[model samples]
Target: MGMSDKMVTVLRRQFEPTVEMLKNLIEVCPDDFWFDAKHKYWKQIFHATTSMKFWFRQQKDEEFIIPDFGKDVTEDLDKECSDYPTKEEMKNYVEEISSVARKFFDELTDDKLLEPCVLYEEITRTDVILMQIRHVQHHIGYCNNILNSNHLEAAKWL
Candidate 1:
Protein backbone atom coordinates (compact mmCIF):
# COMPACT_ATOMS: atom_id res chain seq x y z
CA MET A 1 0.00 0.00 0.00
CA GLY A 2 1.04 3.57 -0.55
CA MET A 3 2.23 5.69 2.36
CA SER A 4 -0.97 7.74 2.37
CA ASP A 5 -3.09 4.61 2.25
CA LYS A 6 -1.16 3.10 5.12
CA MET A 7 -1.61 6.24 7.17
CA VAL A 8 -5.34 6.30 6.49
CA THR A 9 -5.66 2.66 7.48
CA VAL A 10 -3.79 3.22 10.70
CA LEU A 11 -5.87 6.30 11.50
CA ARG A 12 -9.09 4.39 10.92
CA ARG A 13 -8.03 1.48 13.10
CA GLN A 14 -6.90 3.79 15.88
CA PHE A 15 -10.08 5.90 15.79
CA GLU A 16 -12.58 3.03 15.80
CA PRO A 17 -11.75 1.90 19.30
CA THR A 18 -11.35 5.46 20.41
CA VAL A 19 -14.86 6.29 19.28
CA GLU A 20 -16.21 3.38 21.28
CA MET A 21 -14.22 4.35 24.32
CA LEU A 22 -15.46 7.90 24.25
CA LYS A 23 -19.04 6.79 23.89
CA ASN A 24 -18.67 4.39 26.77
CA LEU A 25 -17.16 7.11 28.90
CA ILE A 26 -19.96 9.56 28.25
CA GLU A 27 -22.51 6.86 28.89
CA VAL A 28 -21.08 6.08 32.30
CA CYS A 29 -20.02 9.45 33.67
CA PRO A 30 -22.38 11.86 35.32
CA ASP A 31 -22.96 15.25 33.71
CA ASP A 32 -21.68 16.95 36.83
CA PHE A 33 -18.34 15.23 36.51
CA TRP A 34 -17.85 16.75 33.07
CA PHE A 35 -17.89 20.21 34.63
CA ASP A 36 -15.94 19.33 37.73
CA ALA A 37 -12.99 21.71 38.06
CA LYS A 38 -10.80 18.92 39.34
CA HIS A 39 -11.31 16.75 36.26
CA LYS A 40 -12.40 19.04 33.43
CA TYR A 41 -12.74 15.96 31.24
CA TRP A 42 -15.13 17.57 28.80
CA LYS A 43 -12.89 20.56 28.27
CA GLN A 44 -9.96 18.31 27.55
CA ILE A 45 -12.03 16.39 25.02
CA PHE A 46 -13.01 19.61 23.31
CA HIS A 47 -9.41 20.77 23.06
CA ALA A 48 -8.29 17.40 21.73
CA THR A 49 -10.97 17.40 19.03
CA THR A 50 -10.13 20.96 18.05
CA SER A 51 -6.46 20.10 17.79
CA MET A 52 -7.24 17.07 15.65
CA LYS A 53 -9.24 19.30 13.34
CA PHE A 54 -6.26 21.55 12.87
CA TRP A 55 -3.80 18.70 12.27
CA PHE A 56 -6.07 16.90 9.81
CA ARG A 57 -6.15 20.05 7.68
CA GLN A 58 -2.41 19.87 7.13
CA GLN A 59 -0.90 18.69 3.84
CA LYS A 60 1.96 16.26 3.76
CA ASP A 61 5.23 18.20 4.11
CA GLU A 62 3.26 21.27 5.11
CA GLU A 63 4.02 23.03 8.36
CA PHE A 64 1.27 22.41 10.86
CA ILE A 65 -0.81 25.47 11.73
CA ILE A 66 -1.52 25.83 15.39
CA PRO A 67 -5.17 26.48 16.04
CA ASP A 68 -6.34 29.68 17.73
CA PHE A 69 -7.64 28.67 21.10
CA GLY A 70 -9.46 31.96 21.32
CA LYS A 71 -12.61 32.94 23.16
CA ASP A 72 -15.01 31.63 20.53
CA VAL A 73 -14.02 27.98 20.85
CA THR A 74 -13.72 28.05 24.62
CA GLU A 75 -16.79 30.18 25.26
CA ASP A 76 -19.14 27.97 23.30
CA LEU A 77 -17.64 24.91 24.95
CA ASP A 78 -18.08 26.33 28.40
CA LYS A 79 -21.78 27.05 28.12
CA GLU A 80 -23.71 24.76 30.39
CA CYS A 81 -26.57 22.83 28.87
CA SER A 82 -29.48 21.33 30.76
CA ASP A 83 -28.65 18.06 29.08
CA TYR A 84 -25.17 16.97 28.11
CA PRO A 85 -24.46 15.89 24.54
CA THR A 86 -20.95 14.68 25.14
CA LYS A 87 -21.05 11.51 23.04
CA GLU A 88 -22.90 13.03 20.13
CA GLU A 89 -20.73 16.11 20.17
CA MET A 90 -17.56 14.05 20.19
CA LYS A 91 -18.86 11.83 17.36
CA ASN A 92 -19.54 14.85 15.21
CA TYR A 93 -16.15 16.30 16.00
CA VAL A 94 -14.51 13.03 15.01
CA GLU A 95 -16.48 12.92 11.78
CA GLU A 96 -15.30 16.39 10.83
CA ILE A 97 -11.68 15.48 11.60
CA SER A 98 -12.04 12.25 9.60
CA SER A 99 -13.24 14.17 6.56
CA VAL A 100 -10.17 16.35 6.70
CA ALA A 101 -7.97 13.29 7.14
CA ARG A 102 -9.51 11.67 4.05
CA LYS A 103 -8.84 14.75 1.96
CA PHE A 104 -5.27 15.02 3.22
CA PHE A 105 -4.47 11.34 2.69
CA ASP A 106 -5.98 11.30 -0.76
CA GLU A 107 -3.79 14.16 -1.88
CA LEU A 108 -0.56 12.97 -0.26
CA THR A 109 2.28 11.47 -2.30
CA ASP A 110 4.97 9.17 -0.89
CA ASP A 111 7.68 11.74 -1.45
CA LYS A 112 5.64 14.35 0.35
CA LEU A 113 5.57 12.21 3.47
CA LEU A 114 9.37 12.29 3.58
CA GLU A 115 9.64 16.01 2.94
CA PRO A 116 10.61 18.02 6.01
CA CYS A 117 8.17 20.50 7.47
CA VAL A 118 8.35 22.21 10.83
CA LEU A 119 5.69 21.91 13.51
CA TYR A 120 5.82 24.54 16.27
CA GLU A 121 9.25 25.64 14.98
CA GLU A 122 10.88 22.70 16.70
CA ILE A 123 8.99 19.50 15.87
CA THR A 124 8.69 18.04 12.37
CA ARG A 125 5.46 17.25 10.53
CA THR A 126 6.17 13.54 10.92
CA ASP A 127 6.50 13.98 14.66
CA VAL A 128 3.39 16.21 14.84
CA ILE A 129 1.07 13.61 13.35
CA LEU A 130 2.45 10.92 15.62
CA MET A 131 2.00 13.21 18.59
CA GLN A 132 -1.58 14.00 17.57
CA ILE A 133 -2.47 10.31 17.60
CA ARG A 134 -0.76 9.84 20.93
CA HIS A 135 -2.58 12.86 22.37
CA VAL A 136 -5.96 11.41 21.46
CA GLN A 137 -5.04 8.08 23.01
CA HIS A 138 -3.93 9.80 26.18
CA HIS A 139 -7.29 11.52 26.52
CA ILE A 140 -9.07 8.25 25.84
CA GLY A 141 -7.11 6.65 28.64
CA TYR A 142 -8.14 9.46 30.95
CA CYS A 143 -11.79 8.99 30.03
CA ASN A 144 -11.53 5.29 30.82
CA ASN A 145 -10.00 6.10 34.17
CA ILE A 146 -12.81 8.51 34.98
CA LEU A 147 -15.41 5.86 34.19
CA ASN A 148 -13.62 3.28 36.29
CA SER A 149 -13.36 5.68 39.19
CA ASN A 150 -17.11 6.20 39.07
CA HIS A 151 -17.67 2.43 39.22
CA LEU A 152 -19.46 2.66 35.90
CA GLU A 153 -19.05 -0.05 33.30
CA ALA A 154 -18.63 0.85 29.68
CA ALA A 155 -20.65 -0.98 27.07
CA LYS A 156 -18.88 -3.63 25.02
CA TRP A 157 -18.95 -2.84 21.33
CA LEU A 158 -17.70 -6.19 20.12
Candidate 2:
Protein backbone atom coordinates (compact mmCIF):
# COMPACT_ATOMS: atom_id res chain seq x y z
CA MET A 1 0.00 0.00 0.00
CA GLY A 2 1.05 3.57 -0.62
CA MET A 3 1.89 5.67 2.40
CA SER A 4 -1.47 7.45 2.25
CA ASP A 5 -3.25 4.13 1.92
CA LYS A 6 -1.34 2.72 4.85
CA MET A 7 -2.11 5.71 7.02
CA VAL A 8 -5.75 5.42 6.07
CA THR A 9 -5.81 1.80 7.17
CA VAL A 10 -4.07 2.56 10.44
CA LEU A 11 -6.36 5.49 11.13
CA ARG A 12 -9.41 3.38 10.44
CA ARG A 13 -8.22 0.61 12.71
CA GLN A 14 -7.63 3.07 15.52
CA PHE A 15 -10.90 4.92 15.11
CA GLU A 16 -13.55 2.47 13.88
CA PRO A 17 -13.41 0.06 16.79
CA THR A 18 -13.39 2.85 19.37
CA VAL A 19 -16.42 4.47 17.82
CA GLU A 20 -18.13 1.11 17.72
CA MET A 21 -17.28 0.67 21.36
CA LEU A 22 -18.95 4.01 21.95
CA LYS A 23 -22.03 2.92 20.04
CA ASN A 24 -22.27 -0.19 22.16
CA LEU A 25 -21.82 2.04 25.21
CA ILE A 26 -24.75 4.16 24.17
CA GLU A 27 -26.92 1.11 23.62
CA VAL A 28 -25.99 -0.53 26.89
CA CYS A 29 -26.29 2.61 29.05
CA PRO A 30 -29.55 2.48 30.97
CA ASP A 31 -32.03 5.29 30.42
CA ASP A 32 -31.99 6.11 34.10
CA PHE A 33 -28.25 6.61 34.06
CA TRP A 34 -28.09 8.26 30.68
CA PHE A 35 -30.65 10.87 31.58
CA ASP A 36 -29.75 11.35 35.20
CA ALA A 37 -29.76 15.04 36.03
CA LYS A 38 -26.80 14.81 38.38
CA HIS A 39 -24.76 12.10 36.69
CA LYS A 40 -25.12 13.56 33.13
CA TYR A 41 -24.13 10.47 31.17
CA TRP A 42 -25.80 11.85 28.07
CA LYS A 43 -23.69 14.98 28.35
CA GLN A 44 -20.58 12.85 28.45
CA ILE A 45 -21.63 11.17 25.22
CA PHE A 46 -22.39 14.52 23.69
CA HIS A 47 -18.95 15.82 24.60
CA ALA A 48 -17.29 12.81 22.97
CA THR A 49 -19.21 13.11 19.73
CA THR A 50 -18.89 16.85 19.57
CA SER A 51 -15.16 16.79 20.19
CA MET A 52 -14.63 14.22 17.47
CA LYS A 53 -16.81 16.12 15.08
CA PHE A 54 -15.12 19.38 15.95
CA TRP A 55 -11.61 18.03 15.57
CA PHE A 56 -12.28 16.82 12.07
CA ARG A 57 -13.74 20.08 10.76
CA GLN A 58 -14.06 22.78 13.33
CA GLN A 59 -11.08 22.83 15.67
CA LYS A 60 -9.21 25.46 13.77
CA ASP A 61 -11.41 27.69 11.67
CA GLU A 62 -14.87 26.21 11.36
CA GLU A 63 -17.87 26.37 13.65
CA PHE A 64 -19.57 23.49 15.41
CA ILE A 65 -23.33 23.24 15.51
CA ILE A 66 -24.83 21.08 18.18
CA PRO A 67 -27.48 18.60 17.13
CA ASP A 68 -31.00 19.93 16.63
CA PHE A 69 -32.00 18.98 20.13
CA GLY A 70 -29.54 21.38 21.77
CA LYS A 71 -28.55 24.98 21.22
CA ASP A 72 -24.97 26.12 20.79
CA VAL A 73 -22.02 24.20 22.18
CA THR A 74 -21.19 26.85 24.77
CA GLU A 75 -18.09 27.39 26.89
CA ASP A 76 -19.47 24.95 29.45
CA LEU A 77 -19.69 22.45 26.57
CA ASP A 78 -21.19 19.24 28.02
CA LYS A 79 -23.11 21.13 30.65
CA GLU A 80 -25.36 24.22 30.56
CA CYS A 81 -27.62 23.04 27.79
CA SER A 82 -31.27 23.61 28.55
CA ASP A 83 -32.61 21.04 26.09
CA TYR A 84 -31.30 17.51 26.38
CA PRO A 85 -30.92 15.09 23.50
CA THR A 86 -32.84 11.83 23.55
CA LYS A 87 -31.03 8.51 23.41
CA GLU A 88 -31.71 8.02 19.71
CA GLU A 89 -30.41 11.47 18.88
CA MET A 90 -27.18 10.73 20.70
CA LYS A 91 -26.87 7.41 18.82
CA ASN A 92 -27.40 9.11 15.49
CA TYR A 93 -24.82 11.75 16.38
CA VAL A 94 -22.24 9.06 17.01
CA GLU A 95 -23.15 7.39 13.72
CA GLU A 96 -22.76 10.70 11.94
CA ILE A 97 -19.30 11.29 13.41
CA SER A 98 -18.27 7.79 12.38
CA SER A 99 -19.43 8.44 8.84
CA VAL A 100 -17.61 11.76 8.68
CA ALA A 101 -14.43 10.22 10.06
CA ARG A 102 -14.55 7.41 7.49
CA LYS A 103 -14.54 9.93 4.68
CA PHE A 104 -11.77 12.01 6.27
CA PHE A 105 -9.49 9.06 6.76
CA ASP A 106 -10.23 7.58 3.35
CA GLU A 107 -9.00 10.78 1.74
CA LEU A 108 -5.81 11.02 3.73
CA THR A 109 -2.74 11.75 1.62
CA ASP A 110 0.86 11.63 2.72
CA ASP A 111 1.04 15.36 2.18
CA LYS A 112 -2.16 15.90 4.09
CA LEU A 113 -0.94 13.82 7.00
CA LEU A 114 2.32 15.72 7.13
CA GLU A 115 0.71 19.11 6.89
CA PRO A 116 0.83 21.22 10.02
CA CYS A 117 -2.27 20.99 12.15
CA VAL A 118 -3.80 24.38 12.69
CA LEU A 119 -3.34 23.94 16.39
CA TYR A 120 0.39 24.59 15.98
CA GLU A 121 3.05 24.69 13.31
CA GLU A 122 4.93 21.90 15.03
CA ILE A 123 1.82 19.67 15.27
CA THR A 124 0.96 17.74 12.12
CA ARG A 125 -2.33 16.25 11.03
CA THR A 126 -0.95 12.91 12.18
CA ASP A 127 -0.58 14.33 15.67
CA VAL A 128 -4.13 15.63 15.58
CA ILE A 129 -5.43 12.20 14.63
CA LEU A 130 -3.66 10.55 17.53
CA MET A 131 -4.75 13.28 19.92
CA GLN A 132 -8.39 12.95 18.92
CA ILE A 133 -8.27 9.19 19.32
CA ARG A 134 -6.88 9.54 22.82
CA HIS A 135 -9.50 12.14 23.69
CA VAL A 136 -12.36 9.86 22.65
CA GLN A 137 -10.94 6.89 24.49
CA HIS A 138 -10.66 8.92 27.67
CA HIS A 139 -14.37 9.66 27.50
CA ILE A 140 -15.11 6.02 26.77
CA GLY A 141 -13.27 5.03 29.92
CA TYR A 142 -15.27 7.55 31.88
CA CYS A 143 -18.56 6.21 30.58
CA ASN A 144 -17.53 2.59 31.10
CA ASN A 145 -16.56 3.32 34.68
CA ILE A 146 -20.01 4.71 35.27
CA LEU A 147 -21.59 1.53 33.87
CA ASN A 148 -19.38 -0.82 35.87
CA SER A 149 -20.10 1.12 39.03
CA ASN A 150 -23.82 0.84 38.49
CA HIS A 151 -23.59 -2.94 38.06
CA LEU A 152 -24.52 -2.56 34.39
CA GLU A 153 -22.80 -4.02 31.36
CA ALA A 154 -20.37 -1.69 29.64
CA ALA A 155 -18.53 -1.96 26.36
CA LYS A 156 -15.52 -4.23 26.55
CA TRP A 157 -12.06 -3.16 25.49
CA LEU A 158 -11.47 -3.48 21.77
Best by lDDT: 2
Predicted candidate 1 versus true structure: per-residue lDDT over 48-131, tens digit per residue: 766766666554465654333322235134554333335456556556665765665555554555545333545544555666
Q: What residue runs in model 1 are displaced by over 4 Å at the alpha carbon? A: 1-12, 15-24, 27-32, 35-37, 59-87, 117-122, 154-158
Local error of candidate 1 at 127, Å? Answer: 1.7
lDDT of 2 at 123: 78
Instruction: Report the C-alpha displacement of residue 112, candidate 1, in angstroms.
Output: 2.1
Top TM-score hit: 2
lDDT of each: 0.57, 0.75
Lowest summed-lDDT stretch of 10 residues in model 1? 66-75
- Candidate 2 local lDDT, 1-158, one digit each (tens): 36546776777788888888888888888888876766667777778788778767624666667665654332244356555677898888899988877766765766688888655789777887888889888888988989888899888888
As for model 1, its CA RMSD to the true structure in angstroms is: 5.5
